[model samples]
Target: VFTLRLIHIFAIHKQLGPKIIIVERMMKDVFFFLFFLSVWLVAYGVTTQALLHPHDGRLEWIFRRVLYRPYLQIFGQIPLDEIDEARVNCSLHPLLLDSSASCPNLYANW
Candidate 1:
């Protein structure tokens, strides 16, 4: 009967339709994830720029760490002469940078 054939085709088409939709949705989800990742990468770059050069210490990306005495002493091992030279060199040098805020004159003068 025509009704039987119509019913059979409808069932087959119904199954096929969902598979097609699922495939399309999966592709869309993949595209969206990649798009989100790219946007996050851009956001990360912008956020890093903000964190790297905090003006008033309000940036959230700055990490706080308590430096123990020996840790500080062994880690940065700059001689007093070197520190003085750095201070003098940094004062006269003219490249304005964020990292140099800690040292009165700490830019690599090269």
Candidate 2:
């Protein structure tokens, strides 16, 4: 067919050949970077879950706590003010806290 021969002509074009090769190499590099990123993400998720919500029971909430929260934190959604307030509240009344606080049991100066 005429369309098939036209496609073959463009496939063997001299000017576009190098661009196609570059795109292929770029795709490989991108895949490698994605693999590396995923490994770090999983590690962060697991550590955060262990340190923050060790007794969590629900499956959906566990996923959100581990993966979703850390991913958003990476983009600057950290709750520094809340953490400071919680630390203050914990210091003032360490045994009178409710269920809505987020005080990690890591270190005193954390």
Candidate 3:
């Protein structure tokens, strides 16, 4: 396997052994942080879904709103108008007026 070959190469190079060990440790730390981030995401996502789309029945849409949206928003793809009730003009904006996309609720903005 590729991993076996990589281990063989790391084993053959004495100098690389320490570096590989450090990399493995760093990978473990990265996994830990990823796990932590996932927990927080799920917690926040579920709570936000309950507050913003309590009656959402579509599994796919619910998943998108909960996980995908939050992940993208974290990296600055935030929907400012969608999250703020006052800013959203659902009637004028065709996109916001779409059945799939509703205006933000007062509770969600708060």
Model 3 CA deviation exceeding 4 Å by range = 84-99
* lDDT tens digits by residue: candidate 2, 1-110: 99666655666889876676677689999999989987888788878777754544457756776778777887889746435644443322335333344344444222
Residue pairs with backbone atoms closer than 3 Å in model 2 (clashes) = none
Of the candidates shown, which would achieve the greatest TM-score relative to the real structure? 3
At residue 79, give the lDDT of candidate 2.
Answer: 49
TM-score for each of the candidates: 0.29, 0.64, 0.76
Is 1 or 3 the stronger prediction by lDDT? 3
Model 3 score (lDDT): 0.73
- Give the best candidate by lDDT: 3
- From the highest lDDT down, the ranking of the candidates is 3, 2, 1
Give the least accurate 10-residue stretch of model 3, judged by summed lDDT: 89-98
Model 1 quality (TM-score): 0.29
